[model samples]
Target: MKTVNLELFNNPNTVNKLSIAIKNESEKLNKPIKIMHICGTHENSIVRYGIRDLLPKSITVIAGPGCPVCVTSSKDIDAVINLSLKKNVKILTFGDMLKVPGTEMSFYKAKSLGADIKMVYSVFDAIELARSASKPCIFFACGFETTAAPTASALRDINIPDNFFIYSAHKYTPNGVYALLKSGKINMDGLILPGHASAISGLKVYERFVEDFNIPCASAGFESVDVLLSVLLIIKQINNKKPKIENGYKRVVNYEGNKNAQKALEDIFYLTNAVWRGLGNIDLTGYELRKEYARFDAKKQFDIVYSDNYIEHQKGCRCNEVILGNINPTQCPLYAKLCTPQNPVGPCMVSDEGTCKNWYDGGIE
Candidate 1:
């Protein structure tokens, strides 16, 4: 049991050396390379530290569908809101989900109008709150594997209250990335995989990306040197034409990931085609509670029906394009003007891990 030296990862001298190595590697190919990292935290680190500015002109780092809050479809938001308002169900969610604009209204707005939406820190909080509550409690479960694994573990290990249920908007990152690449919506030479999610899912799930798409993938941590080192690894892989899934954040992420967490996820839920906010529906990306876990599933227990036609982004909000890495926040007309932290016009403006929010906070321009 040893303490991690946080300073070692962010050491200026170490970061400078990594950046130099990235530059040298980029110079070897002398060709434009687009590397997309599908993680909100990675985007925050990149923008917060001005990682893009440190890169060579030939290399471009863009964000993909990373933020769970940003990608949680409006239909799901509307469903949860409907449950709170119409059915008189008590809703529990993360603070970030409160501000995310839904089809008709947001959770914050819903709460203002007498909806019982309580923000909790985790699934355990929701479970504890439901234990004593008379009314049905529905947890608006949102996130990728990192968060989903915990939710699965809670339901499996804990003596969950019978009144508690989950409306899952959880997604599988590997399949989502795969579907995005298959659709030809994004064209990138390499990918910087998510660290936290990969820690739960492992690098093995991403081997298909290298095998089929011939893309170099590196799992990265949320630090200046870690990002730069991941970039260097991808660049080297591209230069050598050796595309494979490499672990840049080796301390946290492993090749097979956490077996217990994986088992919990497999035992609790199954993969299905779920809708992403701006990016329509991707196959086998969303999670649904298994038949055995029906009592704990809000969609099944409450007989919830999701609408086909739902408003994803507000008018003039380019959140969909932003999620796809097709455009940056500055490209949106409502970015800083109509969409601020205090008052967000789109889903991307709401969450901390969101690209637009990170860009606004960083204000790189």
Candidate 2:
């Protein structure tokens, strides 16, 4: 059982006070402040609870490449989709991956065309699936450090069935933010660190970003109050000219993070250059299976083929810009016209944590 926060930070009066503080702090700031957060679940909380609507107009909240499914390159998606098309091979994935765009089609579209694609919630499920499956099964794993740690743990403890293979698309969370800021893709005043992912990877990992950019960061939990408090803290930091890493969700996140989880990652995977859908390639940003675990890697074993073409995001889709904080989803020409959850033209719309999906579902004005 997990302990729940009883803080009434979301209380009408509490939120009202925080809102007042933000407005007052906004008035003290030199210019408009853009605070970027890179977590789909955090974005969901912000939109679902109307947190954006309560903030000062001068303060802007934007999202980065936090959603793992949204950042998956088209070539990777196409490769996995292609792998699913083969006989006696089923591609196991999360529900979100079903609708994500590949070359010209998606896994769901492939499944409709008779591709064997199975959706699983956890890696253990894939192991169980392999135990009973009559044919070869591959787990198309995708996520940040949080999900990666669990996958690593599963691989370390369980002897994967011969029919089981893994297609890893796991990424490191803080590294994504570092790449975004280093490349000048996202021009922001502060950062809202992901609580869940950071809980596994730790807050210390963000020390480099804070030192290099002098940006204020607060590891935030998924709650309206948590986000509101973080917003206030960031505003205070900017006003005081103090750039430091603060833990807004101190109950779960700590200075060091989860040690055992980190150990699993160190043992099972190694850092390497990874290509993001909209963000392009960033060095030491991706997690690949280690040499000892080569037998579990699906790409090497299957000899899968996919074009190296740079056809990642759709030309008209502003998902690339949205992730970089260059533009909003509404600013895109095809946002609601040609793209929606049911019939998505890009990965941003297909993923629930995607900026476009949250905006569309939350109906942000």
Candidate 3:
């Protein structure tokens, strides 16, 4: 591995070089460049620093199905809410999960309505709470591969009491991205792949996109400079008529990724079909608890009945189009009108990582 000049990434000269590269590539292509970034954190960064405004008109960046909270289906949210409302059941989950709206109400609203729901930073925190409480504790597990490894690690080490179980709605990032590409719902020239997810799944996992789809894929870091450099690399690849996987975030990601973490995930969970809020049922995109850990699976341990009533998004919320990159957040009729962050009508407005929320927070149109 060669050392990157860290100063070069931040220097004004490097920014100028990247800008020139983008301008030249746009001129050469003679058409608009569409690059999709598959991470909520990336979307937040782009909006926070006005990266979208700084880019050339030919370059259009769209947010992909990156937000775990945004993608988590309404039915799952309802199930968790139901668990939370049970007098004997105490719901524990990450802070982001608290505000995400279900069909009727959010967990925060449920907590206000006399539910025993507590926000936890980690899965282990839930285990600790379960150890102390005499009541049944259920953790609403949600996230992509980057967060899944840690949850799996906690499950592997922690001794879950009879009253402790996990209601897992966790999904894998690669599978969702692959599903999006295969569905052809959105047209994308290249992918600014997630750095954190690639650090766990490795760069090689995205090789199929380059080989089969002929799409240029680059794993990008979080910084403004790193993202700009990644955009330049993608533009250069498109101009050269070469579509391949590149690692702009080489500092963290490798070809193979974290072996121990991968192994731990494999040991505890298996792939299953998942229902994303916006993307419907994507095959092999979800994680299920291993049979060995069936005792700690909330669905199995609890006598709760799965609701037959289907949970759907609010009427007129174009969150599906927003997630698919077909339209911007402001294009939604309900956006900021009936759907401000304070009074959210859809999942996109509820989650902090959501594109609509990010756009709203930055006052971006």
Best by lDDT: 1
lDDT accuracy of residue 38 in candidate 2:
88
Order of quality (lDDT): 1, 2, 3
Give residue 71's error in model 3 in angstroms: 0.5
Across residues 1-365, which tens digit of lDDT does each residue of candidate 2 receive?
88675656567788788888889889999898899888988888998888989998889998877888899888788887877776569889999988988877889999999998888989999889988999888999899998899999999987888988889988887777787788787778999999889899889999998899999998888878889889989999999999899999988999999999999999999989888987788888789999899899997889688887747777687888887767888998988889988889888888888988988898753
**Candidates in order: C-alpha RMSD to true structure:** 1.1, 1.4, 2.3
Model 1 agreement with the true structure over 224-327: per-residue lDDT tens digits: 98999899999999999899989999989999999999999999999999998889989999999999998898888886767877899888999999998989
Q: Record all residue pairs in model 2 with backbone atoms less than 3 Å apart, i.e. clashing.
A: none
Better of 1 and 3 by TM-score: 1
Give Cα distance to truth, residue 131, candidate 1, Å: 1.7
What's the TM for model 1? 0.98
Task: Give the top-scoring candidate (TM-score).
Answer: 1
Query: lDDT of model 2 at residue 259?
Result: 98
lDDT scores in order: 0.92, 0.87, 0.85
Query: Residue 345 of candidate 1: its Cα lDDT?
Result: 90
Q: After superposition, how far is residue 272 of candidate 1 from its true place, in Å?
A: 1.0
